[model samples]
Target: MSGRLQHKVAIVTGSGSGIGLESSLLFASEGANVVLADVNLPSAQKGADLIKDRYPTVKGIAVKCDVGKEEDVKAVVDLAVREFGRLDVMFNNAGIMHPEDDNALNTEDRIWDLTMRINVKGVWWGSKYAVLAMRQNPTDEAKGLHVGGSIINTASFVAVVGSATPQIAYTASKGAVLTMSRELAMVHAREGIRVNSLCPGPLKTPLLMDFLNTDEKKQRRLVHLPMGRFGEAIEQAKAALFLASDESSYVTGTDFMVDGGLTNAYVTSIGEPTLPPPSSLI
Candidate 1:
């Protein structure tokens, strides 16, 4: 029931806030030695501090990392191995969706490059390095002769469905994540490393809410949700927890949707209110 990840060591990128932050806490609660890596050093440290404060027995560290840079991402995985003695889970959760990432025609080359660099390239770098580390030290019980680990990449539902909202760069990058994850999963299945994507719909994370400037902007997104509500950060964290733990040992190369039924509904109905209606989604 508890300590599902006992003795596991993990690296969660973009742990400054939102889903990353929530997942880091949950991983720690489940007994994983988590490395909170973020571009913002203070934010990452704050999250790590909170976990250490609450669970003194748990081990966690904050690392300043920009997932867009391969070296920084590599450093995150290295730190985990150096500090924890082994690496078991790698959560590539850092991403960006700038205002300039509108429709293809409106989106600029700079925005496209930035989004892909962080979202796509970052995952590649993280996955590349994580595989290297996981391969060296396989702790998870093996089915064949391979010591396997878990790799959870944060993607979005937009990757599967065409979004009229048009964050072309953001959506495309996530699509890459989904396909890349599957590829890695298949390649490493023989090696014992399971790769998967965690696809979340419109969650109330700062990454999404900070961009919605008006009530109408918020409603445009809300209308698509069959549940008529945004998802909570904790909800996604629980999903990550399952994937990170051995409970999902058999699950791999799959897209785990944590959307509030947004992807399933063609004509969505407003449901019971959980989070208050946003006056200004930003």
Candidate 2:
């Protein structure tokens, strides 16, 4: 509604469902041209179609991307630049919590590798490609376009704290994402790019709800939530909107927690731009 991302071009990965879809729609509503990327082509296309149906003024395109593959990651960024002429935001939001991933002793090597490839390596490839394009972003003073952009990677509350439930692979991957974001933020700060990791708390998403089918199972996690309510996808999307917009121009390299007071410990840390590129918080 604020049109904070007006005329900006953004790529949101894992945009087929969950919080990714919510952010894509929110971005479009804020006057951004969105490129919805997912391994599932149809779902990503649906997001694009929804954008076309509701916000006809902005452009929406869908691309099939498996974040685990470097080529797929590069291709999507290329498509965004080719179609929109520049990339303003890159949200490396795609990740997996493999059901098979559990306690270290029980979790198989195959499962760990698979989870790492998509969760940790995916964000890495996504960031690598994002920085490449953001460096070449064309400047257009009239439209408020600049050469640098924002990069957001989706982590989780477990990244900063321990989880007795123990999705070890997933927890480890998110930790990597958070640390990697901080390092990337500093490396490219002078180049005018901002990078941050978004950590969402327990959510009441369909996937999570289905998993927490019983009240006993639900309360097991809810007891830790001071809010006593599971977070909604929109809440996480809103936090992401902040990271993607110029409002967070000076905010980077930190864990942008949307965890509803689930965890208090935060990793503190940021960039330059026509919108005032991020400044390191160190």
Candidate 3:
């Protein structure tokens, strides 16, 4: 498992915190030089600093990037090439689910537009520049490098299944992400690049918890989560690592769900144990 991404260079957007930060740390541990891009300069720098202090051998740089901006995304990719000489993984993990993103009727035009810009358009920009960089630095087989790279888009289970608690804009944006990933995968499949959508269920990230202030609100969200708990960022990072590494070389145009069975559950377990206790408990 060590050095699964040895000698690779990766850019993880929204790396200040949540899944983005966790994945950047994991990728560095596996021997990839990482660029932590975030709109928050100080936060991105802190994340990069953590990696540099811990994984001294790997190069970690913090770049101020707004993924929603094409120029900013392009700069992030260019930074990876300028600093590391090549790009191998592009993790489009930056997104938003605002309080204002409820139902089409209630959600404002501004909120909807912002959500689409960051969640959907951001991925488009990241993929656009990453593909160009990856193609230019195609695998050097003699040097033990592969022929192409991996692109991981952070989608959500909401894209696959409908929810009564509607975040209309967020859900629709993610739907775009799922379909866009598939189309891009097909376009690049013959070119040696593999594209995939990593759909996470309810997570304990700040993005989710910030909205769930009360225990009642939390319980309402957890009712559908079969695990009876929200997923940790590190858990999702492991899945991203698999996609970034050569282990999933043949995987493309797929919706990889790491949802803790939430999506599979029709009626999740009730408050307590659903079945009788074992004899040992008795």
Candidate 4:
């Protein structure tokens, strides 16, 4: 049987590792031509190679792209269109977090700027170029098939709720991303393009592992999460596939929370629990 993305073309940024990499591979496996774009050229190439090796008949290419840079973002989208003849989906997934500065007060100006540039501005640039490319394609009805594209931005549950330990800049930037996705979705609804944000709680990616390396940190973090476990990269990739594919054709301007119920439940106070007064005291 043909896959959901058969013959479609997609561009996934930060696809060298973690969720982006897994999603790129999945997209290719589902018959979409994938462009694996990342700042790390070797890693991006490796991801492309892996996909090509598995699916020899499918097309997969790697391009070095720093999403924060408008020029690089344009080049990535242009390359995808040039090589594949069209762009069907764009995944804006490149992001960074500074380990040394977890709290707002302790974060330096440079760190704050870097996080915003990559996490917030990067999504804006990607959407700008992706929409431009999608516009070039004939309208769904005119093309004789429903073929307007989709844009998926990566956000985090921290954007929805405050974290016990603050990564203030990262959280704030992602919150902006969520809102941006909604606004862009509304603006482009009539154009037949869909925009949505995916919010993954805590995943077992290298970035998260680096922050929660110790047993003590793991225990502390687990208490806040009702699932008591870190999510896998593939899990996030599956969510991306839903948003990217026609499965979510009618779903746009919404936030998909892949948080394992962390955002839904409340944890008790870290050190103390509430108790009823003794009968004698009453």
What TM-score would every model get versus the actual structure?
A: 0.92, 0.91, 0.94, 0.92
- Model 1 worst lDDT run, 10 consecutive residues: 138-147
Off by over 4 Å in 4: 138-147, 268-282
Better of 3 and 4 by lDDT: 3
Candidate 2's error at 231, in angstroms? 0.5
Candidate lDDT scores, in order, read 0.89, 0.89, 0.91, 0.88
Candidate 3 lDDT by residue in tens digits, 165-248: 668999999999999999999999998889999999888989988766678878777888888899999999999999999899
Model 1, span 48-147: residue lDDT tens: 9999898777888999999999999988898898887788899999999897789979999999999999999999999999999998874444322235
Who wins the lDDT comparison? 3
- Considering only N, C-alpha and C atoms within 3 Å, which residue pairs clash in candidate 2? 270-280, 271-277, 271-278, 271-279, 272-277, 273-277
Residue lDDT tens for model 2, 1-282: 568999899999999999999999999999999999999999999999999999999989999999989899999999999998889999999988776777889999998998899998999999998999999998989878898999999999989886647578888988999999999999999988999999999898875676566888777677677676889999999999999998998998989889878796232110111243467433
Query: How far does residue 250 in candidate 1 sit from its true spot (Å)?
Result: 0.6
Q: What CA RMSD would candidate 1 show?
A: 6.0
Per-prediction tally of clashes: 1, 6, 0, 0
User: Which is the leading candidate under TM-score?
Assistant: 3
Q: Which stretches of candidate 1 lie over 4 Å from their true place?
A: 138-146, 271-282
